[model samples]
Target: MTISDYASLLADAGDYSGRDDVAHLFPRFLALAELKLNRVMRVADMEKTATVPLAEGEGSLPAAFLEARQVLGADGRALRALPLQEFNSNGTSAGAPIGYAIVGAAIRVRPKGGENIRLTYYAKIPPLTAEAPSNWLIEKAPDVYLYALVEEIAIWERDAAKAGAAEALKRQAMAGLGLADERLRWGNAEIVIGGLTP
Candidate 1:
């Protein structure tokens, strides 16, 4: 569904709950729902790869980055994730980096040098807005957005019963989305147990 559809549904919800007085806050509810979704949902659709150029072993993370999955060197070697303290104490030897650490919004690679790094990470969901209208989450699972918005609105209106019901539905929708993502990612893969295939 597009942002308009979501807004319309939210309006209907507000009217149904006898809370139309808070209609001006529908956009805020949607924004809050998106924030909650970003914190809770991690699926294949959110995975992104970015090439970051380092200057003196430090580079800014992608704007959409949520969490890094892997960091690779220019030579395609995976860099080990190191603790910030350990990475700092590794000394400043100019060359290729073997480890990296996330420091705030930047990545610090040990063995200070200038090179390009590939970062694979979970990205923030493209929020639904007038400019963007919709995203994968909306297209694939509108119920998730619906229930999440409902929950937020219910909370704002101080309706415990509505909030509780919406929260339960939201959880179910989120779980279903996760399950669908898992099936798409690994349903055909073979399972291995110890040294044997299962």
Candidate 2:
């Protein structure tokens, strides 16, 4: 199926979020998601190209994630802890990731003459962490993990960023009052980025 066809199916994830077991079933979903991508992407290429719902299995994820969880709770764990990342976009959404690698993306599928295409994919970038996380460690799965997956994806937000293009940079000069360089602020559980001027 084209990305569009797959997208339509995921568009309704929020409807399923009603299930309280989203976390417990994350791993299985990862496996299934991997399987689904295998139909389009290569199996050996999964690690760098994209990530799936890998919680508990034979292998381990980036080391930092485990550490961050202890202090920040799950929300603090970021996808950048992994290394050697690559990206692929499947749509034309404005909020879509421009340069950041998303942990997972939202996919919407559209059917074209019986062929399904992925219309848009929302790229959910992992939060950046200051140091390597240590609390979370690579461990074998417990005997009973339902669906073998957990972590239901946040419902597919639209992919709003343009592809292979960036907003035009203007040469107009402006007087700086108090701007700093590369400002990053984390407030109310969200990262806000801007230029720091001084």
Candidate 3:
């Protein structure tokens, strides 16, 4: 669904006068929903990988970066992730970087140089708009967005009954989202090992 479609749903759920009123508020509600979703789950859509060159022990993270997954050198070995304080104190050893720290918008690594490193991370979801058209949440779990906006709209209108209904729908959608996330994270396969009989 698109942003306009979500606005229409919000108007219908809240029984608002028209879409124009809700249209203006769509971005705000969508932003709130995005923030909540970003914090709650790490979906496949949020994963991103980039090759960035470290200059003098640090390199800038992508604009949409939310959290780091892993950092690897050219050899494809995982670089240990360190706290900011530790990285600050031990970031200048010779040879390849042994670890990295996310400080501000940049990633600081040990033994910094101009060498490129692969960064895997979860990125923030892009907001939906008329120009932007759609996002992963819209394509995957649109009801989650719909219910989220409806709940917010109900609170704004001060309708207790409507807010309650919207809240229920939001919870249902969240449960579905959790299930989807789990399935995506771990596929439907059971691991069995047999070594000794008891």
Candidate 4:
């Protein structure tokens, strides 16, 4: 659904709950829902790949980056994730990176040197707005958006019962989204135990 449609639905919920006085807050509700979704939802739709240039073995993560799934070197070798302390203790030496740690918004590589690295990560869901009314989640799982918005509205109203109910529904919708993504990723695949032959 588009942002307009989502806002209209939220307004309808607000009216039902006698919250028309806060109609002006619908945009805030939408933003809050997106924030919550970004924290909890990790479906395939959020996955993104980017090539980041490292200067002296340090580079900035993508602006929309949520969490890194994998990092590969210029020659396509996978780099290991290291704890910040371990990475720091490794000291600075200009060479190929063997591991990396996320330091704030930037990525720090061990044995630092400048090179372009490919990163696969989960990216934040694009927020809904007047100009950009829809996104993958809204298109594929409108119910998730609707229920999440309702939960936000419930919280704003300070109604615990309503908030709990809306949260339950939102989680159910999100589970459906997760199942759909799993099916897309592993379609008709049979599970094998320890790779043993039947």
Stretches of candidate 3 off by over 4 Å are 1-20, 159-168, 189-198
lDDT of 1 by residue, 1-198 (tens): 233355655665565456767768877888898899899799999999999999988999999989999999999999999887888887566668999998889998988878999999999988777566678887788778878888998898789999999999999999999999999999999976677665
Rate residue 48 of model 2 by lDDT.
Answer: 28
lDDT per residue (tens digit) for residues 1-198 in model 4: 243455555655565455777668878998999999999999899999999999888899999999999999987889999987888877666567889999889997887878899999999999877667668887788878888888888898799999999999999999999999999999899986786675
lDDT of 1: 0.85
Candidate 1 TM-score versus the reference: 0.88
Sliding window of 10 residues with minimal summed lDDT for model 3 = 11-20
Where model 1 places Cα greater than 4 Å from the true spot, the runs are: 1-22, 193-198
Residue 63, candidate 2: C-alpha displacement in angstroms: 20
lDDT of 2 by residue, 67-158 (tens): 11111112223222222233333223332222222233221211101121111122221211223111110011110111111121321212
Residue 178 error, candidate 1, Å? 0.4
| RMSD vs true structure, all candidates | 2.8, 22.4, 3.7, 2.8
Sequence-dependent TM-score of model 2 = 0.17
Better by lDDT, candidate 3 or 1: 1
